[model samples]
Target: MKILNLFFIGLLVSISSLASAQSDAEIEKMIVELHKPTKKISDSIGKLMQETKSKIETEIDSVVKENLKLRSDTLFNAFDDNAINELKQDFVFAKKYPNSLAALKLLRRHVNRFIGMNFYDTYVEVFQNFSPEIRNSEKGKEMAQNLQYFKQSKVGSTAPSFSLVDSNGKTISIDDFKGKQYVLIDFWASWCGPCREELPYIKELYKKYHQQGFEIISVAKDDKQDLWKKAIEKEQIESWRHIFTSEDNKNIIKNYNVNGIPHKVLIDKNGIIIGKWKGSGENNKHDLQQLLKSIFEAE
Candidate 1:
């Protein structure tokens, strides 16, 4: 793995050198060429590993031995930490054997740990460095397009004010909840899976703490009234206010830089954004609850 790290570091350096050249065509050509051999090797190893279960142990051993030799010949000669880390992450020895998926999962866990320890860049940098094609990819595009909203939602920044019609069509603004010690302006839609999954927990939290000066103002982005109504009724989400942002209202979405559904912004009574933005699931509820507890206790 260390050797593999060195190999990739060398490769990145080699590629970086070509960046000074003015030709996009040349750079594209080089990217293709450089990625080709590694792709072939990776594909072959993946295929063999997928079939390794039916093979004898001796045959597996032989394959492993051959791969190590190939790796030594191609990768071990390099000496770059970042490159080596990338290569090791991309290729693990256990990937050649049966039950490789488990091994690969473990390898991924370790790789994530390593990256978390060393690369503490914010999510913006992480997304920016991703391949350009990623933005065109389905989920990638959604995230990329919404990056502005997420980035603007900083702790000290002013929470964007909006006047959205509630279920009964009355317009309301952030000022309505002004006196509350904490307010969670959750942006969601009726059709979102993660939002639906989070409803029960959110309801529980809301009910448990609403009297303590915590208010949850839910704004749905659903275009259809019936489905939105059905979800609210079914989920029994009795928050402080349940408002729906009109589908045609591009300004609100653009103002918050909301690119994804189920987005949330927690604002303190003083109107400072405090909690992390949540786009999906119940993952952040526990943290939010803890924060609320602390706030209430402090007050």
Candidate 2:
């Protein structure tokens, strides 16, 4: 009787292993299919950017340059829409299928982008609906915790507090601006091209809004204080609050979950976060413009 029971147990284990192998293979196939369009789109955009740059330099007519800029902007907008829709569909598939290893893998790959783009709530919901064993894994626990931070940083949540010395060695904290000003927390690095490119727009906005209680606090993830200072001086940045990641605030970037350069978080006069944007692209530019204009209307 003991031998017979052992034989049955071994058989069950063998079948389980076979099923697991098959499941892994199926997920691998899905991941490949998932990445195909993403890669294609990225390559297409790379080529388009190169072509646009060539045209921008060679063709000097002002009207033609403007038309070229509009076409480039539309292409980017369309690409973003398509990519976001595909990602949304992937999450829906995960929810519908539930416990899909492929879905979790895909989510893991794009989790930071989702967080950056403010899809934290949806990601948390779908991830939590996964199997209990998976939801309780180390990766799952870490992601769940990050989701909490993401929630805290969302629009309407109070901005996180921190104290750091600015370029002039003046200590600055979130409390300094509470009930006092509409603050723009610009997370950027001196070496980043996109960050540098957006500086002009930031200067324009600040010039228009400073009298209306708008203030900008630039944050840097730079290692060299001298280079940072030089950039500011050369670029003619307004002598406002600027914080660099140095001895005092090396972990400031982590605290804010800063995943990329040119990230901006807007805080309302009452200290609540009004909006968050990442990258120095058209989407963030439009968002920043709209928020500033709304404040203009109120003033």
Candidate 3:
């Protein structure tokens, strides 16, 4: 029922058996009291020793997963705006209580999305401020690499370029739209459910900004052209340009260093990479929405 849901229900990795963090006496007491198994829904099961934090959190997570009961269902539900917001809330807790066993559990569970929140500097700060052991551990080193990539791939980086073909077999490149219109290079595919789910967002952005000099190019990584075209038609993605990506021609993915699908790269009129986002997280949607607002409303 809480945001710790991010690190649990739809997150990753093995849970580390944890003890409770050292909280103020009142908070520690409260945390203990809040989780006790009892006649009242709010009863504390037992006193929390340092080791109790990990066990309690893991137990709670197990209950959550059992309640959800289906991994596919959990993933499907976790990509929308509501889910995104919940994940952000969990990240907030993770940031605020970085040293708390619950926060540590959440961070490791949602490591990919936590790093994906690089748009929000506070999350980065949480990583920077983690305890010496955690911050210097293997996970920490991986996070550091992710942070570096996130920083370099941010808004204002040069948009990478490549040549590909549209639906009609017309060759297309970023150069075509550079200096003329704002372009959104969408990296997606037909078989990707999350990518399909995100088409409406792109359509909405196009409808709002196309008359104001916005254009879009889709790089489809679909091996099956029939399925790809059907999905585009099914989604009514007729207004924008569509390009088919060959296995030997995966520059859109390789050049941008995209690690996931449904990745959106926004470029300004001059072809400067204005913003980029990857993942189905709420913060990712928010970042794109904010970028759209700034672009269309700007002087």
- Using TM-score, give the best candidate's number: 2
List, residue by residue over 60-149, the lDDT tens digit for candidate 3: 577654543343233334433343454455566556654554454445444444344434465577676677776666766766665655
Q: What would the per-residue lDDT of candidate 2 be over residues 214-289, giving only the tens digit for each residue?
A: 9999998888988999899888895578988876676667666687888899998788988888776766788789
By descending TM-score, how would the candidates be arranged? 2, 1, 3
Q: What lDDT would candidate 1 get against the real structure? A: 0.60
Off by over 4 Å in 3: 1-152
Candidate 1 lDDT over 117-177, as tens digits, reads 2232233444444455544556555555454554455556777777777776677777776
Instruction: In model 2, state the lDDT of residue 57.
Output: 75
Q: What total of clashing residue pairs does each candidate reach? A: 9, 0, 8
Deviating ranges (above 4 Å) for candidate 2: 1-22, 34-46, 114-118
Candidate 2 residue pairs that clash: none
- Each candidate's lDDT (Cα)? 0.60, 0.79, 0.66
Error of 2 at 53 (Å): 3.5
